[model samples]
Target: MSVLSDLLDADWARLCLLSGGGLRPRLWRHVLSPRFAPVLLIRTAQCLHAANWPRLAKLPALVNFVLFGIEVPPRMHIGPGLVLMHTQGTVLGAATIGANVTLYHQVTLGAKDIDFTYTMSMRPIVEDGVVIGSGAKVLGGVTLGQGCVVGANSVVLNDVPVNYVAVGIPAKNLPPEAERSHEPTIDQSITM
Candidate 1:
């Protein structure tokens, strides 16, 4: 199988392990499966810890917790390549997330109200390759355009334009020249 296929298979296997009913064998399978390495195991454990340890504690939930690093309620639909950098404190509401999205720590993607009375009440729809920074909150039926960068600690209450950078309490788009000057460089030694 190709790498993507392998990842998809692993993701499916993980989902089955997490939400499925069987207990002892599932746990054993998760531990003994050669498909899961040490890093994945540790990350899975952390996701379980964050998820308050669901009943049956199936492998799928563990996989979702570890790989995606977002606390996606089982009902939520998420596409593949959901990269979670610093997965801790990320909460995904009941919404469909697209593929290849990168989320940092402390991001929230939830609805404003549980009651369906308001027509405007809805969750955020994250598009592909959209990078959300730490502590950013995208609330209420907003569409994050593709390849947009949400700056750290920004509160995004409006739809962001594609390929733009948003930063502030109520996020505003940065000018093209200013955005160009704000390229972030990473040190390989640091953890994502």
Candidate 2:
């Protein structure tokens, strides 16, 4: 699909996520929301970079950084339907992030070590329908499985299985029955 199509889908998905599946938000309402503005800029940067306009891509990225304190590289691969509950101080350096991922403020997903050069092996791979809570740090080349949840302020360095919950420092998977206890209150409507 074209970048514009993907961006439009993303915007609609974000609106649905934010509005609790009630009335569809108007274009101006979605565009004017503070929370959605940074996401739009990031998406624009990603599209520009993918189109081989790297120099122009940096403009939106720079604006996002200056306005929201969020640093998202134009090269980062992110699927549509990403909802950042709060944008400030959130740094995303993932190799590939799948669809319907929700991230709260102060969430950091990046290299575990000092690797200035970004590579698949040095970054986190987040699967679809994942929710990362505020102040969480998911480091290294770990894979966060589909539908899994990461608790706030946790440090994850290993892989998490699908539908599981990871909490605490050096996060370990919670028992299947205990998943709901750790998951945040956000209503995740995305499936698959």
Candidate 3:
């Protein structure tokens, strides 16, 4: 599919429409109506909150709550078409996230503190089309490049390159070119 089509997919667009309350709605409308440049920021925050984090599989029901008081730390930078599937209790620290990223529930993109008063010098940078799975904790100054997929419940502390899939506690990359053949495909072969 085309980039624009993917970006403006019906599911994502619908999520954007239902993000915030009075001010949030106004702001979101203003951003989306004109196709604003910084619309990605709103999308990122809204998706992260709406994804029903901390709850592995109950996202769609949570989207109806009035998300007026949620805190999306302003230190983070988010991109467009970001999908937060089951995004509850997700905390994003001072980091940069690229376009079309997907984050699952209970994901914490936080920083390690060097001292009681000082946060670590580095933070995470998530590139385009990256998928961060449920209950994953991506800490420190790791840079995940384009198309990287992080598996569920993984804890990431190292850098990952494009098209690689990382899993486990330290989040190591799968074997080279493993993602191409091992991509997750949910089958409905046992249809009702």
Clashes of each: 10, 0, 9
lDDT of 1 by residue, 58-141 (tens): 465556566645565544445555545565667767366766666778888877667344233388888876889999988888
Question: Runs in model 3 with CA error above 4 Å?
Answer: 1-11, 14-71, 114-121, 176-192
Tens-place lDDT per residue, model 2, 24-55, is 74475676667788888888899899899999
Q: Which residue segments of model 1 deviate by more than 4 Å?
A: 1-70, 115-121, 175-192
Work out the TM-score per prediction. 0.58, 0.86, 0.57
Taken over the whole model, the C-alpha lDDT of each candidate is 0.63, 0.86, 0.60
Model 3, CA-based lDDT: 0.60
lDDT (Cα, tens digit) per residue for candidate 3, span 31-131: 33423222333443344544544242223222322232112453345666665655446665636888777777678776755423325357788898888
**Over 4 Å off in model 2, which ranges?**
21-26, 178-192
TM-score of 2: 0.86
* Clash pairs detected, candidate 1: 14-59, 14-60, 15-60, 17-58, 17-59, 17-60, 18-58, 18-59, 18-60, 18-61
Order the numbered candidates by lDDT, best leading.
Answer: 2, 1, 3
**Residue 142 error, candidate 1, Å:** 0.5
Worst 10 residues of 1 by lDDT: 34-43
Q: Worst 10-residue stretch by lDDT in candidate 2?
A: 183-192
